[model samples]
Target: MPAADLPLLIEAVRMAGHVATGFVGKSAKRWDKPDGAGPVTEADLAVNDLLHKVLRQARPDYGWLSEETEDSSIRLGHDRVFIVDPIDGTRSFTEGADTWAHAIAVAEFGQVTSAVVYLPMRDLLYTAARGKGAYLNGVPIQTSAVTDFADATILAAKPTMAAKMWRSGVCPVFKPAYRPSLAYRLGLVAQAQFDGMLTLRPSWEWDIAAGALIVAEAGGAISNQRGASLRFNSADPRLDGVVAGGGLIHAALLDALA
Candidate 1:
């Protein structure tokens, strides 16, 4: 099932990437979303519309959930759903940075089965299917084997390192890194480019759904902030946070955060 969906997601995400690249540095009209939900651009909506039309047309029975689309309880009734973030880093895209990505996934019974994250400017395509492993540009990928917390290089916003968040009351020492797109951070972890990634604030499902499956298929561990398994297509469409990395580092990070 995942194998069938994998190619579909890859094609959809690649097409979405093409649409997004057209707006890069071209001054696509942008504005802040109401309630400070971050920025949105004409490119975002265009890409969203294209993806919605293409994917839904191909899988009429599948439910739909996208960052650009209004929420609908209709998805909860379907056994399979498509979760998408047409542009995972609006700020990066608007600022003419190349780190933004198109994240897409198919979820069945709340578990993601197939996923893809495409960064057009970077020419990076990350894909994965549950039980089939992860890949980067068609080559297999895996999480870093680093187990020592202090030696790990982690991707996260500076706020995640705040002393109060960890049980130690002082941030555990690890090299810190940052990426504007949540999906790309997870992809980097899947590629073993970083030891792990996390965020303390609530995360949107579209931003992390595809990456979650990629990381898992790459032999990494991922979960909500409290170390619970991550589920997709929730009615609220948000998660407490995300913690993902190689197995030993993932466990150690969870232990330290606890």
Candidate 2:
């Protein structure tokens, strides 16, 4: 029954966003993460450092887990943890695409208690606290009311469409949206801009934790591909995937993907 630390979470993300915005378009050091995986820029490190210091100082008892930081088994010992992605959609950020966001969430007992996803470039703030509902720029928001699967508008990847990931090899009625930031995609669903959003591949916790809570509080449902509730601050810190939308649309999408 504990409530989310909404105010602190919001402040931390906005502070991180400031550091991110300062380096969005300007020149900064960039490199691969040893495995030739994804790109990491100076902005990511700067924001991560600031959040790590600020949030941990504010809540010394909370554990820390972030995309930019190396995984630490020590976090597993705590009942509460701060899960963060300094900048989701780093690809878009590095390219100055204005689609990146700072994603942060507080997880206690395997569920997010509070969350925030801030897109500094767009000057948008999406936030949610457990049992308090969700909001976008201080206005309450909800998911679309579309219940029919055929009419549901989904945000998805081009590859998913080409591979026919949907049930019966049929895509949604409208063109699938392509947003680089997974957090932004979920935020959009919370705002009812899209009926739902999905991904079949494994997703990092930092990528979807904040967004999941936001969607859930906005009267939407969130779960992995199997429709299982997502648990965070895990030792693995990764999820099978995500499927979220308005109540009925969510159920229908799960049925389709199933």
Candidate 3:
């Protein structure tokens, strides 16, 4: 693990985010991926191209995996790889919403060794390193200790798919705040703004790689709905679904979701 590469990784992601922010509301161009539901704007491709170029030039050894590019099985061979989401919330990006952002992280084997998330619209940068702790704009951060579900600032996507799953036979009164970007949503958890978050469907590794590390280093924890720690570099790219808050309420969220 070239753990020493944290600074370079952070700088690359910040620069990549700045480049992506340039295209907001400009109506440059856009398209969909293989699936018609997944939006891919010109900014996504542009930022993707920039990240590929910069990250490759900075750390030639790190394998690359991103949303705008094709899948690669070569990452299985590298102990460390750069997992990136050029623009995590393309829907919000094209809509000129402030919820969108960029995510980048270094995964050693399956663990995230470092992470950096830049919210382009908000000009916010969140970062973390394994065992080193998390920071939001360089200020140290940690998760909320709110154990009471009624008081906990719950968060999740709109329509509340996971909320329905949790309320179907349990915790019917709990209401989690709906959020857009998975990075920013999870960043809220790492920053202690929210206590728990639930994701109903599977997500790409890039979307949560940096967020997961932010949670971890902030003295919080994360896992798929089944309560498993997240890992990157799978051929399918759909890593897993649903991660609860860290700290005391995590177990409760897991039990309710389970």
CA lDDT scores, all candidates in order: 0.93, 0.88, 0.81
Candidate 1 local Cα displacement, residue 3, angstroms: 0.4
Per-model TM-score, in order, reads 0.98, 0.95, 0.93
lDDT of 1 by residue, 32-85 (tens): 899989999999999999999999998999999999999999999999999999
Q: On residues 132-243, what C-alpha lDDT tens digit does candidate 3 reach at each position?
A: 8899998999898878777877786654544357635545345568777898888989988888787868888888888988888888878888888787777676766857
After TM-score superposition, the amount by which residue 138's alpha carbon in candidate 1 deviates from its true location, in angstroms, is: 0.1
Worst 10 contiguous positions by lDDT, candidate 1 = 17-26
lDDT of 1 at 26: 43
Clashing residue pairs, backbone N/CA/C < 3 A, model 1:
none
Report how far residue 37 has shifted in candidate 1, in Å: 0.3
- TM-score, predicted candidate 1 vs. hidden true structure: 0.98
How does candidate 1 score on lDDT? 0.93
Question: lDDT: which is higher, 2 or 3?
Answer: 2
Q: Residue 85 in candidate 1 has what lDDT? A: 94
